[model samples]
Structure formats: C-alpha cells, structure tokens
Target: MAERTYDVMILGAGASGMMCAAQLNEKSDLSVVVIEGNEKAAKKLKVSGGGKCNITNVNVSASNYLGDEQLIESIFSQFSKEDLLLWLEHRGLKPVLRKEQYYFCPKSSEEIIEILKAASAKSDYKFGEEIISLSKEEHFVLKTKKRKYKAKNVVIATGGKSFGSLGASEIGLELAASLGHESISFLPALAGFTLQKNAFWMKELSGISFEAEVTVAGKTLYEDMLLTHKGLSGPVVLSASLYWSKGEISINFLPKNNLVDLLHNNRRLLSTALPLPKRFTQAFIVHLGIKDRACVDYKNDERALLVSAFHTYHLAPAGTYGFSKAEVCKGGVKTETLNSWTLESNILENLFFAGEVVDITGELGGYNFQWAFSSGVVAAQHIIENNKV
Candidate 1:
C-alpha cells in the first residue's frame, strides 16, 4: 500500500492539535491531517472541568503559568483570551462565565469540540494510530503501528503526561529530544500533596474545608483548602503545588481575621475563638502541643505561639499525589529553544510545538486550556504564513 502524505501533520487530537488544524483550515489551503492515538478526539477535553470544560479565565496573564514568562506573554499578546472568546463567539459558541472568573461551555465541552470539528472540516483525521517513531529527512516521516505517513511540517501537540488514561504521554518531549532539543522531565502539577509524618493529624480532619491562604515559593494564593485522607487538596494547595518543589509551605488558617485581634480579651477556648471549623481547630491545637484552655489564661509567650500557629502554620509535604491525580504536568521542551512568536523550534527546521508539550503549565482554572488554544493558533499562523503558495 502507498504511504500517506500531507503538507502538515499534527500529532494528538486534543485541544491544541484540533485548534491548530482548525486555524490552518481557516487561513490556508494546505493539505492538513490530524493523527490521534485514541479512537476519538478530545478525550481529555470531554472530561475536563466535570464535562463542562473551562474554556478560559477572566484574568489571564503570564503570571498564571510556570514557564518562560516572556514567551508566554508574547504568545498571549498574539492570541489573547479575548481573541479566543471572539473566535468562539463567532462560531456561535458563547462560553458562560462561572464563579465570575472561569468561562465554561454553557452546556458541555462537546460544544467547543463540535465547533472545532466544523472549523477543521477540510482536514483529515486518522484515529487509533499510535505513533511509534518520528524522523525527518527531506520530509518528516512518522510511523504508527498501522502504517507510515509523511508531512512537510509537523506540529507536536502531543500534550503532557497528566491523564494517562486519556492517552497522555511524553512522546512530544521524547520527539523533541530526538531532534536535539533540551527539555525538563514532566512532573505532576495542580495536584494534592501528601503529608509528612508530622502533619498526619490533618488526615483526621478529612472532609473539612475552609477558605485560607497558602504561601509557597514566594507566591501567595487564597482559596478554599480541603483536608483529605491523603493530606491537603484544593484550589489554594493545588496552585501552590505548581511552585512547591521542596521545603516548607506556610498556611494561614485564618487569612481574613487577625489572630491577635480575635484573641484579645476573649475568654473562650482556643478551638472556639478562632472562627475555623471546630474539628480542624481542635486537631491543630492538639498538633501544636498547646493545651486547649481559655484564651485569657494563656501567658504572653503562649499567646504569641497561638498567634503564629493560626496565622503562619508551616509544614512540609512529603510529595504530590503523582500524575494519576494531577490535573496537569509541569516541565517539557524548554521555551528557550523555540521562537517566542511562532513556537517553532530553533534547533530543527519545520518543527513546532504547542500546548502542554511545550514546558508551559498553568495553575488550576482555565489557564491551561487558554495556553493550549493560544499556542496552537500562534504555531498554526506561522506555518500558514511560511507555507503560503
């Protein structure tokens, strides 16, 4: 049989791959094909955000990501979240804003998927073909378990290794490495942390959640924190995990109230005066090795200790919950090796990268998806301009 060939071939039919193919179809007449390992496309998109995918966020900036800030800023400038919303709105899919920040599909993730499918109607799709190897000579050659294919330009949209069940892998990173590009190994991001032995008492307060502030790696995030069987998991902790590699994280159990002011002249028990969940406060008081007594009975040193314990609780996490529970993965092909404007590899000609595969991971919310879409469009636009007939 004859091997398939195309002007451009995109790996992974996830958010980035589909967006790139859609852009190419809209702006250029190049023969485009999307190759996906899964039987269908957008497997992760279909399940993300509990089926109603978070399309983008109200506030999007380079600060929301853990990567080359300048590169991210460049990409966002070219295709900002506003551009994304306009693109979707023009396609008759208006994402609804949830929690006054995140924009989610009003109905389901399928809404956006269908729009992408329609936009890329001119492109061909080869599903259930897992790429075994990729090599470039005159044209890039890709081999799958089923057959071989070739393309003039290739976009590695193969995403990070987060949802392994959804067919996520480090193939994109591996491919870039084979072509002489440096990359950091992927690690779990936006995931919960397992407690160290000293923090095991937190497990006893499982199911308790409260609004608090978490400070790690010089960044502070205020959001709901959940105490779980493992240790801690919630928006604040997950966001903090993005910056936390090692060392202690500070958690303010009462971020809104001043511990000193709350304790002043109050005669109530420590557990009842702090305005936190009784169970959590009791556990915390016990863990701190301080007797649970009337607030007025505490000495000056004890008051200072209580104040610090409530406002600047510090603990080191053993590790993360691993990729199985991770929403995204950090570290991939370093951004230094790619064109900031186009996401094209400086090391190899005709090679581009987009989405999670490019070493840019966003905190929990819609930032990751926004990055996927923005990077995809930027790469596709460059390809279209270069391949113009």
Candidate 2:
C-alpha cells in the first residue's frame, strides 16, 4: 500500500494534543492527524479533577509553575486563564470558578472533551495507533506498527510518565532527545509522601484530615492535609511535594492558634488541652514520651519542648507514592532547546513540543491544565501563521 501523507502529524491526544488539533483545524488548511495509543482520546482529561476537570485556575501566573520562568510567562501572555475561560465559554463549555482559584466544568470533564472533539472533528484521529519509529529526511516520516506516514510538520504532546494507568508515556521527551534536546530527569510531583520510622504513627491516623500549613524547601502552602495508610497526602502535602525534592517537611498543625499559651496553663491532658484533633494530639504526645499531666505539673522545659513540637513537627519522608499516584511529573525536555514563543525545536524547523513533555510543570489546582492548553494553542497558532513561509 502507498504511504499516507499529511501536512502535520500530532502524537498523543491528551489535553495538549487535542487542543492543538482543534486550533489547527479552525485556523489552517493543513491536513492534521492525531495519533493516540490509547483506546480513547484524553484518558487523563476524562478523569482529571475527579471527573469535573479543573481546566485552569483563576489566579494563574508564572509563579504557579516550575520551569523556565521566561517561557511560562511568555505562554501565559498568549493565553491566560481568562483567555481559557472565554474560549471555553465561546465553545459552549461553560466553566465555573470555585474556591476563588480553580476553574472547573460544572458537569464533568466530558463537557470539555466533547467540545475539543467537535472542534477538531475535521481532523483525522487514529486511536490505538502508536508511533514506533520517527525519522527525518526531505520531510518527517512516522512509522507505526501497521502503517507509515510522511508529514511536513510534527507536534509532540505525549505528556509525562505520571498516571501510567491512563496511558502516560515518555515518548515525547524521547523524541525531543532524538533531535538534540536537553531533557531533565522526571520526578513524581503532586503526590503523597511516605513517612519514615519516626513518623510511622501518622499512618494509624489514616482518613483523618486537618487544616494546616506544610513547609519545605523554603516554600509554604496552607491547605487541608490528610493522613493516609501510606503516609501524608491531601492538598497541602501534594503542593509541598512540588518543591520538596527530598529531606524533612515541617507541619504546623496549629497554624491558626497559639497552642503554647493554652498548653502552659491547661489542667487537661495534652491531647484535650490543645486545639488540634484529639486523636492526633494524643498520639503525638505519646510519641514524644510526655506524661499526661496538668500544665502546672510539667516543668518549664517540658512546656517549651511541647510548644516547639507543636509549632514545628518535623517529618522525614521515606519517599513518595510514585507516579501511579502522581498527578503530574516535575520535569521534561529543557525549555532552552525550544523557542519560547512558538515551542518549536531550534534545531528542527517544523518540529515542536508542548504540555507536560516540556520541562514546565505547574502546581496543584488546575495550573497544569492551563499550561498544557496555553502552550498547545500557542504552538498550533504559530505553526499555522508560518505555514506559508
């Protein structure tokens, strides 16, 4: 059979790939084909944000991400959270702002997925087809198990190696490496941390949650934290994991209250005397080997020790829950190899990278989705505008 030909071939059909295809379909006459290895498109998209799909954040800025700050700033300038919301509204997928930070589809992720599918309906979709080999000569050649295609341009949006159950892969980074690009080692971000021996008592409090502040790597985030059977999780812990490459994390369980004063003058047991959860306080007090005595019964040194412990509970995590539980990867192909404006490879004229496959990784609460959408749109528009050249 004769080899197929197209002007552009987009690998992966996740958030970025589908977004790019949709934009190209509307603005350019270039023949586009989206290849996805999964049985369906946007597998992760369908389940993101517990199916509601936090598409972006209302307070998106370059500060909310980790990567080349200049590149992220440039992309957000092209498509801000406001732009994403407006674009969704225009496409009939109304997004609701929640908690003054997250933008979510009121219905489900399917709402946005359907809009993207409809917008890119003109483009061909090859589901269950994975590109096995890619080479370049006069043009770009992509070979799958069953067929081969030649295209003038290609876009890599294969995403990161997180959530492998949803079909995440490293092919996008691998492709970039083939073209002489620098890639950063990927680490699981936005995941729970497993506690070491000293903090193993936390595991017994599984299912318990509290409002607190977690600090690591000189960065702090205040949110709800949950004690899991494995270790620590929830919003605060997940966010802390973004900045915590390793070492200890400090938790302020009583961030809102001054427990030291209350504890010093208390007549009740340490567990019930403080404002923290009774179970947690009891377990912590016992772990510290403090006698359950009246405040006056304890010496000044003991009071100070208890106060210091409450204010700064240090925990050394053994590791993380790994990629299976990770919401995103922290690194990818370095941004210096790609043009900040177009996300195009500096060495290859028509090759481009976008979304999580790049070194840019956003914090929790929909920042990652926004980055994917913005970068994909920017790359798509750039490719179309320069197609005639």
Candidate 3:
C-alpha cells in the first residue's frame, strides 16, 4: 500500500459523501477522495422513492425530524429547502413535484445519480474499499483494506445501517466512537411493524388498505394504512414507526366520516353501514366480539363501543421488521458533540459527521435526503471557506 495525501477523505460514497465531494471539488482546488465499500455508489439512492428518487420535500422544518431539535433547525437554516432546489436546478437536474410536495426525478432515480456523478467527476472515487480504522495525528490517518490515506479533514458520510444488503454498516458509528463522539442506540425506523399475537386478526385483512390516521408516541399521521400478512405497513404506519419507541399505536379506521351518525339511522348490517372495506369491517366487528347485526339495533353503549373501536383502535406492535425493511435508522452520533453549523466535531479537529450517520433522522418523505445533502454541503462549505484563508 502506498501513502496517499488528499485535502479530505470522505467515507461512504452515498448521498452526503457525493454531495460533499462534488461541492468541495467545485469550490476549491482541494484534492478530495471518496472511499466506498460497495461496488457502486449510491445504491440506496438508486432505489429510493420507488426508484424515482424523492430528492427533497417542499415543506421541511425542525419538527419534521427527531434528534437535537436545535441542531437540526440550525442545519436547515444554513441550507433551506429552497436552497436545495435551486442547487439542483442549477446543476441541470430538473425534478418534478408530485404527491403534494415531494420532489422526484421524473425519469428515474438514475437521473439524480447521474447528476451527482457528474458533479463529483473531479473527485477521485475508490469503490470496493472498506475502511478498517482511522486515527488523527496532525492530519487524519485513515486505513482501508486496500491502502492508507492521509487528509487534513475527514467526513464520515457513511449512512446508518438500514439496508444491510446494500452494504450499509456500522463502520461510521464505530469510527465516530473511536474519535470520542456520543451516539444514541440505533433502531429500525420508517419500517413496517410485526403485529402482536393478540391482534393476529389483522393478518386476515392483508392486502386491504384504507386512508386512515395513525397515532403513536403522541404523533399522528394521516396516510394510507396497509394490512399485510406479517403486520402493518404503508405510508402512515411507516411514518408512525419513527416515533414508536414502544407502546400501543392507535388508528382511526374511519377518519373521514362520522361512523356513529351513520350507525344511528341505518338498518344496514354493521359491516355494510360503515365506510370501510367489507373484508376489514367483517374482521373488525368479529374481533370486537360483535355479531354482524343491523346497526340500528345497537344501544347507546354498543354504539359508543363501535365508535371507540373505529376512532381509537389501539394495538401494541410486537416489534419492527428490522433494518432489512427500514428506510432509515432512528439514531446515530449525538448532535451536541458536533458543531451545528459546520457538522465538525466539537472535540475532534477537522473531523465531521453528516447524513443519516448523525443523530438527526428525518420523517418519511424527502426530508432524510435533504438532511444528507444539506449537512454535506454545510461541512464542505466550511472547509472551502476556511481553506481560502
């Protein structure tokens, strides 16, 4: 192995790593290099947003994420949602906004990946190189399986361990710990939930979906709830999983209509009167231990029970589907240890953390990618601005 020197060495050529390398190369004459373990870069980004790549959300705020709220807010302040869009458009990556405010590449995820590759064309990328260890002595000394590299600054853009099959690992976390950074325990977030044995009835409602509101851990989201053979999923369930540490998740099966009023005047069967899938209604009423009697025959108490069942159906999940099915991990290196603006470690000189590897995990949508890109840009900007002096 030969000794190589560079201005900065970024770990993991994912979203943040690519962004930082591209911007840094563009702004200054700094020699930058990206180290990746996988055969190709941005494997996760290539599969994101169902292959279309949700670039960023039109609406982003401090409340759209979980972690050090102050740190997250300050990061966004340096790089806002509009700032990201302008940067993308300036780079000729025109994205389309759909499903309300989510920005996605109309062609495919490859469009965004291509743009990133082009942007970072000047930076050297070493794929299939796994980082074994790192140490700082005047300059950051990083060791990989294939070679040794030294740099003035280091950026750990390796994402959280979500899709292990895509080559995600805990190396970033381990490296951060080695450099004296705090971390919150990692858990599967934005993933499906396996049901408890008590609510095994939900399995029968597999393939059935309804637009409902789900609440867990004091946060509520209104989106499509999907019933699966293993458990619950879909937009709302996945969103709720981010907040669900451990507790019962409540759902409003009928959020759009007042089921009680419909039940008061109708003689229709309990399964037929309410606005829900017949299969779901049948399973729900049966699980409630109520026969499919005419809705009008129910007394006030019975009606109340029905209302409660519809409005506040609570079930404790056995556990999440794990990192294999998670879109992102819920935790990472603690925020207090890093400078909120530059993402540089407070205690470690010229060392920074960015992307999902940091403690801040955004909600489902493009918030995660935005955080990655923004934090990466922030770190690179600080380096570029300071290097000029």
Better of 2 and 3 by TM-score: 3
lDDT of 2 by residue, 1-389 (tens): 76667888899999999999999998888899998989899999999999999998877888778888999999989988888888899998888878877889999999999999998998899988876777898889887778777888899999999998998988877777777888998899999999889898888899989998888988888988999999999988988898888788898888988876786567887777777788888888888888777766788788788877888999888999999999999989998889999999998899988899999998889999999999999999888987876
Report lDDT (CA) for all predictions. 0.93, 0.88, 0.89
Q: Where in model 1 is the C-alpha error above 4 Å?
A: none
What would the TM-score be for candidate 3 when compared with the true structure?
0.97
* Least well predicted 10-residue stretch by lDDT in candidate 1: 1-10
Arrange candidates by lDDT, highest first: which order?
A: 1, 3, 2
List RMSD in Å for every model shown: 1.2, 1.6, 1.3
Candidate 1 structure lDDT: 0.93
As for candidate 2, its clashing pairs are none
Best by lDDT: 1
Q: Give the C-alpha miss distance for residue 378 in model 2, angstroms.
A: 0.7
Give me the displacement of residue 234 in model 2, in angstroms: 0.5
How many residue pairs clash in all the candidates, one count each? 0, 0, 0
Name the lDDT of candidate 2.
0.88
- For model 1, how does the per-residue alpha-carbon lDDT over 27-81 read when each residue is reduced to its tens digit? 9999998999999999989998889999999999998999999999999999999
Model 3 clash pairs are: none
Residue 201 displacement in candidate 1 (angstroms): 0.4
